[model samples]
Target: MKIIYRNNDRYAIKKLLLDIGEPELERECWRRKLHKPRRINLFFLETNEGITSLKYKYPQKGVETIIDVSQYDLPECGWIRYKIPY
Candidate 1:
């Protein structure tokens, strides 16, 4: 699967998966976390299948935290991607 983050371009899961065993992808993920702004807001993930999920992430005490939406009936997409601005 692929995602278009912040309108930059679509990125495949291979480019963003943390457990993919790719050093460059891991570095890119870190770079994104570092560059992402620290704010409380909603983020959207839209899939090619027309399913959308809402999420949020922030830093808490030096650790990155994500607002859990696991209770919601999100579609079984392979992974989360495509950060839409709120």
Candidate 2:
């Protein structure tokens, strides 16, 4: 797992997990915290996945943060990849 910290920490987790490839996704978990500079955390449901922590200012007054998480089950390869979008 890759953990990235950014001034806009909200996008860090999303950037970290986007590499994972998933077929479909269901639920999501989100959090806002009081850290050095404030941030957001998100966890995707239906895949037992979690985005540990994020530190970013909620969009001041712009477009919402768009995040997409998915799950891919490769029966033949015996593996599952979860793709989290930023």
Candidate 3:
């Protein structure tokens, strides 16, 4: 997945997800300690059905999550790509 920002930490990602009603994902992120200096990569894409999916991987914890955010209204930044991350 392509990272929107190289410096984005899990704290920022969790806050955004929580604000968007993704409490489960937010809780899951805290399952393990990401003490490394490396930041986690957050990947997002809009599906053909117009649903935007956000995904992230926690390699150290062996976990990953995908969030369907079609119900929420996301601000327009003129940078969201519809392509799915591979």
lDDT of each: 0.35, 0.30, 0.45
Error of 1 at 58 (Å): 3.1
**Cα-based lDDT at residue 21, candidate 2:** 22
Ranking by TM-score: 3, 1, 2
Residue-level lDDT of model 3, residues 1-86, one tens digit each, is: 54331213455454556566545555544553332223435433333445455555455654344556556555344343333386
Show model 2 residue runs off by greater than 4 Å: 1-8, 24-40, 44-86
How would you encode candidate 1's per-residue C-alpha lDDT over 1-86 as one tens digit per residue? Answer: 45442211124222222223446434544655643433323233333445332223344434332222233344344453564454
Q: Report how far residue 43 has shifted in candidate 1, in Å.
A: 3.5
For residues 1-86, what per-residue lDDT tens digits would candidate 2 score against the true structure? 53332232334344444443222111122322222222335322222244322123344532233233333221122123554555
Worst 10 residues of 1 by lDDT: 5-14
TM of each candidate vs. truth: 0.22, 0.19, 0.40
TM-score of 2: 0.19
In candidate 1, list every pair of residues with a backbone clash: none
Looking at candidate 2, what is the lDDT of residue 4? 31
